[model samples]
Target: MIKRIYPQIQGEIESGEDVLEEYSRDWSIFKINPSAVAFPKNSSDICTLVNWASLENKNGHRVSLTGRSAGTDMTGGPLNESLIVSFSRYTNKIISIGDKEATVQPGCYFRDFDKATLRKNLIYPAYPASRDLCALGGIVNNNSAGEKTLKYGKADKWVKSLRVVLSDGNEYEFRGFSGKDLEAVMARGDLFGRVHREIFRICTENKELLEKAKPKTTKNSAGYALWDVWDGRTLNLSKLIIGAQGTLGLVTEATLGLIIPPKHSRLAVIFMSDMKEIAKVVDICMKFKPESLESYDDSTLKVAMRYAPEMLSVIGAKNIVKLAYDFMPEIWRVIRHGMPKIVLLCEVAGEDEEEIKSDLDRLKANLSGEGFEVRLAATEEEAKKYWAIRRHSFALLTRHAGERKTAPFIDDVAVPYENLYQYLPALEETLKPYRKFFVYTVAGHVGDGNFHIIPLANLSDPKVRALIPRICEEVYRLTVEHGGTITAEHNDGLIRTPFLNIQYLPEVINLFEEVKRLFDPLSIFNPGKKVHGDIAYAMSHIK
Candidate 1:
């Protein structure tokens, strides 16, 4: 049937075992061989594919499709037996670039998009650290936020509009709904209109419930962001779809809102021997109103030093290194200052260089009072030296872990900023039982209380896999207690999907299910993903 439908679209469709295997898994260890993969060239091709998928099969089951770009998602969002509509190859293109917005196909790489925007002095600030490899479509689906997220916000905030394709083959550019748009939608009285109207009613009716259900953390990327759809005044479908992880609908293209780049940025890398001091340091850093504050625990630094020695020369910060050495005898201290238990990277930005410098100086003075030795970046190049450690910390773990891979199952948790001081130790205590086998290393956007808990384990071993459920229960219990989200930055894909019920109220989960049904009633769009599926299903197909 797929072979027959291949000729209907301009895009290429391959169903051979070799081709299917290529589309199977993403960056995640989870793997599920797709039945077929399609490289769609345009929206027409996607529309045709989606419409065909909506058709009933011999057993009365409609074929399903999963939208994919880059296939670099850590979660198993793109892995399925259904047809995979991959956008990373032929469909990658910037449709149009405007003064404050850029319309791009789902396949365009984030780094490529950023470079194109930079030519016009415009910037897309929500790109993840893996921007070089991640695609813009993936960012929108995951609603990713990077180092500058504190100032510019997540991918959803930057998305002005979305060109989405519904399961029934209807394509629409969703930005927001107005009186006329709502009236027009209701006038049609079709499935799309009904879904739209139902969504509006659901959002408006559950506004308070939705608000109360939100995690107290500064940022979250879990389940459906129902709270964002209705902002008390406007009804925006794009906001709801932004972080739905392609389960609700397939995004063919996205029109992203851009911002002016910061004129100057000054960075400070502070080191503290005690893990407990991290909370105090973060509290002080927050008072300065810096753009981003990141932290790296001792375990992460131990692996980082293997790569850090060569970074100074690679970034070309020779002059700054000499000046920093003169400023303090401790400059000769190793990159991690003999592997301090905790390392904090704080960055402040503005239009004036002197102002940024003054802010950095004040931050340094404040941190110094708390017994922190600060390594102020004399130039942007010098700052990259510090940023390099944080940026490539995950890579270092991957490199060092010979056979055992760093499983991010419990990574990207964000507690309320104030709760972070207490949350860290409790989390460590939670993992103590499995400490012998599971390696725990913490690093991430500490400024927002979001940290990546890298728990390394050889999943090939049944012993390690057995402890996963218990470990997860303990960790999530602590996360819930602290008013934090079980999944932060990384959307609740397959790994976290089954855990949604535990994180959110039953009523909230019902809303997520309703949203899924309204957009994908036939369940032809990434089924068994966010709203539906069990933990056993999530735990299947390990790479």
Candidate 2:
């Protein structure tokens, strides 16, 4: 049927068992086998496929296009039961790089992009922890963030423009515009103009409601983000599309702004015995304006230690002896401190080495004055050891947990920094009842108050599987009550979409639906995501 309807397609369309099986699962807990997977060679092929899907839907055949890149999404955002449109196969490219920005295809690997930017002493700083495995499309779709987000903000802030193939089967460029530029766009009288005009109207009419619906957390990737579209003067559609998770349209190309990284950097490690002073610790750290503030619980540290041998593959260790030598100080510290309940890594970066070292010295003195075990990394190589644990803890659990697998349902919750003292304990209390079913680890961007709690569960056990919905309900309720968002970086895919209403009022949800219909009237894009996500359907598809 695909060959007949879109015979001009310049890429492969596979429905074979192996291909379908490969596209069935992502990093999330769900498993959904799409009918077929289409790899478009270029933007023209994507437009053709969109037009074909639209025609099929009009002919009483139900089909939709779900855009996917590296398939590194942890919320089932790239999974669909209809047709999967993967870009990594053919559409991957780094088109051009300038002094301040670069244009790239959706499927461009972040690791590759990072290397290119490093040559120019520039970086797209909103990359997630999965930088080695993720693609630009997933990063943009999820509005991704990482350690540097404390200073540089999320993907939405760096995205300068996007070329999206809308439900009308036409590609249009979207960017921020005001004054005569905005009027020129709305005056075109085409689908693009009509879209801008209608969206501007919707935003202007419901400005107060949209403002009220904004999440209080430092970062959010849950809903439509309609509140960020119009700020009275400039209307930026890219903000709405950045975190829409491909529900609005297929992003064929994107131009992202970049920043020059600091010339010198150092790390300050803080070992906390308990959560009693977490809020104070964060407050004190914020005063110094660290480039990155990250934390992980004792469970993650233990996992890293138990899988110590695996560190050689990730941390660039020369040999086991060298690895042990590099780890000797930390090992002795653990022996003396008996393992801290939480480990915080504060990175200070600047143009001058002495200034950064001075800053770290002052930070260490202040933290040590508070009676905390603080260690200042003497070199950049030493800092990598702490980062290895923070970044690869989830990978270690997923690979070496034997019968258990990574279940990231309640991951990516973020609250205000001031509430961490109470919110962290409440979150742990909520998860304590499920300790019998699974063991979990906590890690996140401490500066942004975002945490990723990944549970290792044996899904084969009925009791373990049954705990998913219950845990999601309880934890999400607690998150909302604490004035937080269900997701801070990972968007509302199949896992968190059903729980969006808990964080937003019904009226705002209605506006989200209205925006959905505005861009994807035919609902040919990724559905059941951002809106209309049925909990039953989501739970039934768990692997």
TM-score of model 2 (CA atoms): 0.98
Worst 10 residues of 1 by lDDT: 323-332
Give the top-scoring candidate (TM-score): 2
Highest lDDT against the true fold, candidate: 2
After superposing candidate 2, which stretches have Cα over 4 Å from the reference?
1-7
Kindly list the per-residue Cα lDDT of model 2 for residues 287-327, writing each as its tens digit.
88999999999899888877776865686766656665777
Off by over 4 Å in 1: 1-7, 57-59, 309-337
lDDT of candidate 1? 0.81
Q: Which ten residues in a row have the lowest lDDT in candidate 2?
A: 1-10
The TM-scores of all predictions, comma-separated, are 0.94, 0.98
Tens-place lDDT digits, model 1, residues 43-111: 899889887877654348557889998887877888888789999888899998889999999899988
Q: For model 2, what is the C-alpha lDDT against the true structure? A: 0.90
